[model samples]
Target chain A: MNEVKKLPLQEAANCLTPALRLAVDRLPEQTARAAEELRLRVGQPPALSYGGQETALQTAAVTAADLREIVARAARDSVHSYADSLRQGFLTLSGGHRIGICGTAKVENGNFEGVRQFGALNIRIAKPVFGCARGVYEQCCRGEPSSLVVLSPPGRGKTTLLRDLIRCAAASGARVGVADERGELAALRDGAPQFDLGGPADVLELCGKQDAVMHLIKTMSPRIVALDEITSAKDAAAVGYAANCGVEIFATAHALGLEDFRRRTVYRPLLSIFQYAVEIALEEGERICRVHPLKEGAPC
Target chain B: MLKLLGAILIIGASGALGLSARQGLRMRIAAIDSFLKALSRIESEITYRLTPCDELIALLAGENDPYAAPVFQDMAERLTHNDGLSLSYKWSRALREAGPACGLREEELGILCDAGSFLGRYDSEQQRHSLRLTAARLSAVRDEAAEDLKTKGGLYRACGLTLGILAVIVLL
Candidate 1:
C-alpha cells in the first residue's frame, strides 16, 4: 500500500504495450505486488504469473503483429543491434527486466543464427529485494573470502539475494566485479546502474558469462566476482578459473538443495569450486533459505 | 499616372508569386537531396554498425541539417513519446507533418512512408537493401524536381510578367 509496492508495477506498466497495459492496470494490488512475469503467446490471451501461481487475464488474444510491435518497442526500434540477445532468446530492457523470447530459431550450416518472428514473450520483472542479504553475509562470507554459490529453483529470489550480497561486499570496501550477462544484476542504463547496490561495482553488460568473468578478473581488479544462472560448461570452467586465481566467486544456480545441486553433470566443476552454498526456497510466503559450509572432499 | 501605377503593382505581385513558385520547387529538390543523404547514412549504419532505427533517427536529428533534421527529429520523438502508435504509423505521421514545411508533396511524402515501412521490420541485410532502394527512389524524385525547376523557372517569371500586363490592360 506504500511507495515500495507500487514501484515495480509502475515500471513494468511503462514498458507494456497499450493493450497489455489495459489488462495489467486492472490487476489487484496484491497480485500486482507479487507479479513476477507477464506471458504473451500468439493467438492466446495474456497471462500473469506471480506469488507462485499463474492467472489468465481477461484481455484480447495477442496476434503476430502485436508481438512484432512489442518486440520493436522493446528493442527501441533497433532489432539489428540486439542480434546477440535475440539469438539467445531473451533481451533485457532498460530497467533490467528480461523479455524471454520464444520463436523459430534461424539456423545456418548446422549452427543457430537468431530468433525469427517471436511468437511468445515472457516478461520477467526484476525485483531487487533491498536488505535481503542482511543476515547471510555473516554466515557465508568467512576467512580468505571463500567462494559461495547460491542455489534455488526459478523465481526464488536468487538474483535479488546475490545483488544485495554484492552490494554488501562492496560496501565493506571489497572491490566487486559483476558479469551482468543480461544486465539484470546492475540494471545499467547509459553506463549507470538503476538499482542502488550500496556501493559502486564494476559490471560488464551484454557480454557472455565465461568471457566476461575472465575479462573482469583481468581488467577490473576485484576481490570478488558475481554472475547469475551458471548453466553452461564454459561458465563452470570460467568460475573454476576465477576460483583457481584466488578471486572469490559468488554465483547462482537452479537447485532445490545440496543433493540436487551435485546431480547436474555440467555443474560438477563449479560445485567443487564453491566452499559455501546458500539454498533458497519459497515457503508460506516467506523465503526459507540457508548457508551451508561444504566439506573439502565432497563427492561430485 | 494612375494607370501606370496600377500596372506596376499588378506586375510586381504576379512576379512575386512566380518567384515564390520557383523557390518552392528549389526547396523541394533541396529537401529530397537532404533526405537521400540521410538515408545513405542510415544504410551505412545498418550495414556496418548495425544501428537500430531509433538510434539512427536520433543521430539524424542531431545532424542539424535544416531540411532533413526536423523530419528525423519528429520520427525519433514520435517513436519514443507516442507509446501506442506502431513504428510505421509514427513514421508516416512525421513525414506528413513535416511534408508541407519542406515543400514536399503528398506523393513525395508517400515515397518516404514506403521506405519507413521497412525501417525496423527486417534484419540488417534486408533493411540495408530496403534503404538503398528508398534512396534510389528519392534520388529519382529529386531529379524530377530538378527538371521541373529547370524547365519552369524562366517560364514562370515570363508568365507572371505577361499575365500582370494583360490584367492591367484589361482593367484600363
Candidate 2:
C-alpha cells in the first residue's frame, strides 16, 4: 500500500475488522435461537413490540486475549494508544453486537469537523420479527404512487415500517430498491432476506445512501426505491433525482408532529418531485397521520 | 556437643535462606510469565490486522482496481483502542530486560507500538469477507485488553512481593 493510503485512518479500520466479522458470522448462528426464544418468552409490554429478534452476544466472548490482540495489532501499526479511537469512532461490540462506523471528524478540506464526535456504534442485533412491520405496512403503502414520508421522533418504527412496505410494494409487483445503508431495513437473513422482496429487489447496503439511490435509478429503473432517512441534502437530491425519473419513492424522515413535518417541507429540496407526500409523524406516543396531495405551489 | 549445636543452627539458617530465595525466584518467574503471555498475544494481533490488508491488497492487485480492494477501517479502530493496555505490559517486560531487543522490535513485531492512533485507516469494505476480518480484529482487541489488565495486575503484585521478600532477607 502507498504511504498516504497506508495512513492512520486506514489502519483504524483494519484494526477493527476481525472482531466485527467474527461477531457477524457468529452473531446470527449463536444469537439466532437464544435471542428468538428470549424475544418470544420475554416481556410483552404494550408500549414495546417485541420485534422478535435476538441480541448479539459476541462481545460476551471478548476475552483478555482478544483485547491484547487488538492492542498488539495497533502496536504493530505504530499506534501507541487505543483511546484515540473513541475520538474518531469505534465499533462497540455491545457484548458481541457489531456496529461498524467511521470517525466523528476527519482532516477534511484540511479542517476537522462533524457532529459532537460520534465515535460509538450500536449494532442493533437484527432479528426477524415476522410480524414486526405488519402493523405499519398498510399505513406506509396506501397510495397511488405511494410517495410516503414516514416520520418518527427517533427510536420509532420508521425503518421497520419501511422494511415491511418494501415487501408490500414488491408483493404488489413494484420493483423496489432499498438503500439499506446500515443493514437495518432489509436485515439480510443469512445472505438473502427473510422478506420475499420480488425478483431480487437490489438492496445496496453499506453503500452510501445517495450513491446507491443514483445507481438503482440509472441501472435497475425501480418502480419504488425505499430509502430510510432523508437526513442530508445529498440524500434529498438523490431522491428528487429518482422521482424525476418517474419512479415512485418510499422514504422516511424524522419529525414530531404534522406541523413539524410541514416545517420539514423546507428540507424537501428533493421531496417536491413526488406527486403524493404522505406524512406519518409521531405526536406524544401515538402516530398522528395525514396523507397530502402534493402539487405545484402546495405545502410540500 | 557445642559444635553439633552450631552446625544445627547453621543448617536451620540455611534452610530458611533457601526457602526465601526459592520464593523470590517463583515470584520473578510468575512476573515474567505473565508479561510474556501479554506480549505474545499483542504480537499475534499484528498478523491479524496485516492479514486482511494483505488479502485485500492481494485481491485488489490481481484485479488492478483500488476500488475493488476491500477496506475495514472500523475494525482496526476497535482493535487498537481497547487493546492499548498491552503497551504497558510490553513496557514492563522491556524494563525487566533493560534492552532494546526486550523493549519492542517494530519490524519483527507489527504492533503499531505507538498507541497514539491505533485505529488509523480502515475506511470501508468492498466485500463481506472484509467484514469478517473486522469481526476478528474487534474480538482480538476486547480479549487482549481484559487479559492485559488481569496479567499486569498480577505481575505487578508479584514483582512487589519479590522485592519485599528480598528486602526482608537483606535487612534481617
Candidate 3:
C-alpha cells in the first residue's frame, strides 16, 4: 500500500528566488506541508494558499526580477527549453508541482509567441495523498474494471483521488495506461516514473490527451486508460471510443457536483460512457468523496 | 674569440624574444578562432536542440582547446557546484578569473563577458540572435589580430636581428 508522504512544500520553495525561498522556509512545518499553493506578485508580499484561503507571509514585497529568476531557475536557466509550457502559461516542475504564469503575452500574427515580463506566479504544490481512493476502489473497482469519471470543482483533490484510484486498479492485476499530458500524474524522469504508479502501469508523458488515449488503446491495449482534465470534445470522443472498445476509462473533470457535471453539455457524452462519477469535496476541513452511479436511472 | 661568442649569444637571445612576441600574437588569433567555432556550435544547439546553458558549457569544456577550454571548464565546475547564483553571474566571473590567461586582448575579454548576459535568458530566436551578434563582433577582432600577425610578425624578427648587430658593432 502506498502511504501518504508529507507534501513537498519546502521543495517547492526551493524553486523560488533566494529571498522568497528563505521567507517560505521560515514557515511552520505544519503550515508548509498543508499549503496548497505559493502565490507571488510584483509589489505584494508573498502568500500561501490553504484550501482556497490565502495567508500573506511577513516577507518583503516581490519584484519583477524575483519573478524572472524563479522562471529561469525552474527552466534550469534555459527558458527556451520550456517554450511550449511557457506559452501555455504553466510549467510542471520535476516533482509534479505546477507554476502558473501571469505575464504579458508576446503574440505574433495572433498566435501566442510566449510570455514576457511576468507579473505574477501561482506555484501549485502537488500533494499525492495515497490511499485516499480506497473507498472508491472498494465500491466501484473491486471486481470487474469499470469506466469512471472523477469530478470536482478546481482544487478539490480530484486529480489526487484519480491518481490513487489508478494505482489501486493497476495493483489489482490490470494493465493501466496513463496519458500524462501535463506530467502532473506520473512525473516521469529519465524514462522512469517518479511516482510509484504500480507494477502494471505505463505512462505516455507530455502527449495530448486525445492522441494519447487512441495511441494507448491501439498500441498498449490497456485494460484501463487514465487521463487528467477532460476539457474538450476531442477528449470526450476519445473516452467514448475507448469505452466502446471495452477498455475501462479513468478520467477527471471540473464541476461542482453530479448535477453541475450533467448540466455541462461538453460532459454529457462522457456521462453515458462512465458508470460512476466520484465527487471529491471539502467537508468540515476534511476531504469527502461520494461515488454516484450514472446508469441512466441510477439514484442521486 | 670571446667577442665573437658574446655577439652570437646576444643575437640568439634577441631572436628568441622576437619569436616569443610573435607566438603571443598567434596564440591570440587561435583563441579567438576557437571561441568563434564554439559560439557557432552554441547557436545551433540553442536553435535546434534547445540545450541548457549548463550542458552547453560542459560540452565546450570537453572540446580540449587550450585557450577556450579552461574558461568553459571553470564555468562547468561553478555550475556543477551552483550556489543559487544566476548563470550570467557565474559565466562572467569565470571569464574574469580564467579569461586573461587564454591570451585574449582586454577588449576581446570584454566582448566575451558581455555575451554571458543574454545567454539562456530568452526564447530560442532571441538567443540565436544574441549569439550571432556576439560571434560577428568576435570575428571582427579575430580578423584584426590575423592582420597584425601577417604584417608585423616579420617586422619583429628583422628588428631583433638588426638591433643585435648594431649593439655588436658599437661594442667592438
RMSD of 2: 17.1
TM-score preference between candidates 2 and 3, better one:
3
Question: How big an interface RMSD has model 1?
Answer: 1.6
Candidate with better TM-score, 1 vs 3: 3
Residues A164-269, candidate 1: write the lDDT tens digits.
9898788777888899887778877557787766675899977888889889989997789998888888888888878887898889988887889998998887
* Model 2 Cα lDDT, one tens digit per residue, B61-85: 3433222111112222233455433
Query: Cα lDDT of all candidates, in order?
Result: 0.81, 0.46, 0.86
Classified by CAPRI criteria, candidate 3 counts as medium
Q: How do these models rank on DockQ, best leading?
A: 3, 1, 2
Q: What is the alpha-carbon interface RMSD for each candidate?
A: 1.6, 10.0, 1.0
Off by over 4 Å in 1: A1-5, A108-111, A282-286, A296-300, B1-5, B46-59, B62-64, B72-91, B114-126, B150-155, B168-172
Per-residue error (Å), model 2, residue B1? 67
lDDT tens digits, residues A1-300, model 2?
A: 665532212222333336533443443433333331111111121011123333433243433334334433432433222223322333222121223333245555875422122333322333333444444455444544356677666656676566666776776677888886655565453256544455647887556777898888878878888888878777788787777778778887777744576676555564456544545555674644455655564333
Identify the superior model by DockQ, candidate 1 or candidate 2: 1
lDDT of 3 at B37: 88
**After superposition, which runs of candidate 2 have C-alpha atoms over 4 Å from their true positions?**
A1-121, A131-145, A187-199, A269-271, A275-300, B1-172
